[model samples]
Target chain A: MKTFFTTGKGICIVGIGIGITAALLQKLGNPPNMGVCVACFVRDITGALGFHRAGVVQYIRPEIIGFVLGAFASALISKEYRPRTGSAPIVRFLLGFFAMIGALVFLGCPWRALLRLAGGDGNALLGLAGLVLGIGIGLYFIKSGFNLGRSQKTYFSVGLVMPVIAVGLLLLLITRPELKTGALFLSTKGPGALHAPLLISLAAGLLIGFFAQKTRFCTMGAVRDAMLIRDFHLMKGVIGLLAGAFLTNLIVQQFNPGFTGQPAAHSVHFWNFAGMLLAGLAFALAGGCPGRQLFMSGEGDGDAAVFVCGMVAGAAFAHNFAIAASPKGIGPLTPLFVGIGLVTCVVIGFTMRKKI
Target chain B: MMPDRIDARGLSCPQPVVMTRNKMDTSKSCSFEVLVDSGAARDNICRMATGMGWDVQVTEDADECILVLSKK
Candidate 1:
C-alpha cells in the first residue's frame, strides 16, 4: 500500500494522534499542558541516572525509552535502519546542550509550547513568536550557506547502539535498581512526580514513535519549511496538532483559557520568549527538534545520540546551576545563560558558513 | 457567475490549499468557492488565494468555513 504518512491528510492524522494521546496522557496523570515534553523527560532521565541531583525532577521516564525502542522497531521493519555518524558531532552536541538549556529556561520545548497554547495558556504566544524569530535567524544562516558536514554511513553495530541503550534504560526502569541507597531517584513531587502509568506512557510513546518515524514529523522542520520555502505541507500537521489538542482539552475540561495560574506556567513573558528564541535557533542549527532528535537516534543516527547525551548533560547543568526556570518565574542566572547560548549559536553559525 | 467549487472539508491544511491552487492553476475561471472544516485550513487557503492576487471572502460557520476567491 502507498504510504499515507507523508501525505497531508496522513500527517494531519499523525498530528491528531499525538494531540489526543498527549491529552489522554495528561488525563491519565501526566503533567498538565505537558503530556510529552521531550526536554523535560530527558532531564528527568538525567536525574534518575544520577547525573544530576535535582531532587524533584528525577525519574527514568519509560516514555523516552519507548520512543527510541519504538522508532527502532519501526525502522527495522521498514529497512530504514542505516547507521550513520560523523556530521559535526561536537557542534550538534553543543547545539543540543544549548537547546535544552533554552527549553528549560522557557520551561518547555516547541511541542510543549503548542500544547500550552492549546490548553489556553496565553503565555505561549510570546514563546511561539520567539521561536519563529529564532527559526528565521537560522534560515538566514542557511541562506548564507552554513552547513554541517555530511554524515557518512557507519557500521551496523553503530545503529544498534542507541536502541541497546534504550533497552538498557527500559530494563533499569523495570528493575528499579538501587541508586546509592533506595531505588533509582523517583521524584516525590513536581513535574517528575506526575506521570501516567509506565505501560500507558510507554505505549503512547511507541505509537507516536512509529507514526513520527513514518511521517518525519518535526516541529522545527514544520516552522523551518514554512519560513524558508513558504510551504505549508509540514505546517499542516502542526495546525492539526494544535486543533486536535484544543478540541481534546475542551472535551477533557483541561482548557483553562487564561494567562495566569496555568499549571506549571509562569506569568513572566520576556524570558519565556527569549528562552525559546535561543531554543528555536539551537534546534534549527542542530537540524531537528528534541523529539526529532530522539526519533533520529532510534533510526540509527549516532550523531543524534550524541545530541541526546548533550541534552541530558545540559539538563544536569541547568538544575545544578539554577539556570532552569520554575513556575514561579525565571531563574536567577537565566538571562546570562540565554545570552551565552545566543552568542555561542551565532558564533557557530558565522564560523561554519561555507565559502561559496 | 456560477463559481467553481472545491469541497475540502475533512481534509487537512495544505491539502485544501493544494486543491485550491491546483484548481486555480488549471481552470479558466477566475473565481472559486472552497469549503474547509478547520480555521487553520481556511486561513491558509485564504492566504494562498490572496498571495496569488485573488480577492477572498470568508464565511465562518460553527465548525467550518467557506471561502470565495475572485480575481481582484
Candidate 2:
C-alpha cells in the first residue's frame, strides 16, 4: 500500500475535520462551543454507563465509538498497527485517570481549550495559558529524560483488545444489555442522552479517524511544537481548524462569545487555565492529548488504550464522587483530586527522569 | 532553489508546520507547497506564511488544498 499521509499531516486534517464537525453539531442543535469534546463526551458516556449517576451528563456517544473504530480501520489499512505494552501500565492508567480529572476541573481538553477560544470564550485565554504552563513542566521532564520505557511489540491480539472492547460496548448499547434489573448501563437523559444520529456521528468519527490516522493531528502537540521548537506546522493546522470553525460558526450564527454561560464551560479563569495546564502537561508527558490518545489506542497501542480506559474510569469517578467541576464551581471532591493529580504529575516528572 | 513541496495533506496539526520549519531553514527561495485537507490547516499555514514574509498563493483542489509559498 502507498502511504502519503504522515503523522503530522493526519493531525492537521483531523483537526480540520473536528473543527468542521463541531460547527455542524452546533448548527444541528448541539450546545455551542461543544461540537466534539472527547473528555466531555467520555464523561457523558461514564454517566450513561451508570458510573456517575449524574442525571444531566449521561449518554452513549457514537462519535467516540467511531473514533476508536475509525482509527482501528485506518491503522489496519496503513499497516501501522502495532500492539504493544508493559511500560508502567498501571502508572500510565493512573496518569490517564488524573488527566481526566484535570480536564474536568478546567471544563475542557486541549482541543476544547482551543475551540473555546475560537468561539470567543475569553475564559479559554487563561485555560490556554495554563495548558502552556503544564506542557512546559512536562517539557522539563522530557529535557531531563523522563522516559516511560520503550514499549515492546506484542501479539497482534493485544492491539485488537480495544477494538473488541469497543465492539462489545456497541453491542451493549444496541441491546441495552439488562445485566441488572434496573441497571443496564445506558444514559436516558441529560447531556449523555443528547446525541446526533448514531450513523451520522459514527460516519463522521470514522472519516475523521481515517483522516486523523493519515495525518496524526494533536492539539497539545500543536502548541508544544510552537513553544518548544519555534515551529508552526501543526500549529498551522490548529489555526485552520479554528478559522474554519470560526467562519462556520459565524455563518451559522453560533459564534457566541464570553467567559460566562458558555456551553459545558465555566468562568473560573484560574481553574480553566490550571485544569488545561494539568491536562496539557499530562498530554505532553503522555505524548498526546485525549483525542490523540484515543486514536493511538485504536491503532493498537495498549498503553494508549489503557489511557482511554483510565479516562473513562476517571470520568466515572469524577461524577460519581462529585470530583468533576460544573459551570458553577468545582465539584465536591475536585480539590482533593486535583491536588493528588498535581502531586502525582510532579512526582512522575521528578522521579521518572535520567540524571544526565 | 529546490522546489520542495511538503504535502502536509494527510499529516496532523503540528507535524506539517514542524516539517515546514525544518525545511525552511535549509532552503532559500524554495516553494513550500503545503497541501492541507482542512481549511484550518490552510488558514493557519497561510497566516504563518504571511507572518514569515513568504509570497503565498492558495489553490483549492477538491477539498485538499495546496499552499504555494516563495521564501524571502
- Which one wins on DockQ? 2
> What digit string (tens of lDDT, one per residue) describes model 2 on residues A154-262?
7889989888887876776677766654445555554555667777777777777777766666777777767766656667568768877887888877778876788
Q: For candidate 1, what is the TM-score?
A: 0.82
RMSD of each candidate relative to the true structure: 10.6, 8.0
- Candidate 2 regions exceeding 4 Å error are A1-4, A7-13, A178-181, B1-72
User: Chain B TM-score of model 2, please?
Assistant: 0.79
Question: Candidate 1 lDDT (Cα, whole model)?
Answer: 0.83
Residue A22 of model 1, lDDT score: 87
- Strongest candidate by lDDT: 1
> DockQ values for all predictions?
0.02, 0.04
lDDT of 1 by residue, A17-114 (tens): 89888888999999999988899899999998877887888888888888898888887886667577887889989999999999998888899999
Q: Where does the lowest 10-residue lDDT sum fall in candidate 2 chain A?
A: A1-10
Cα displacement (angstroms), candidate 1, residue A19, comes to 0.4
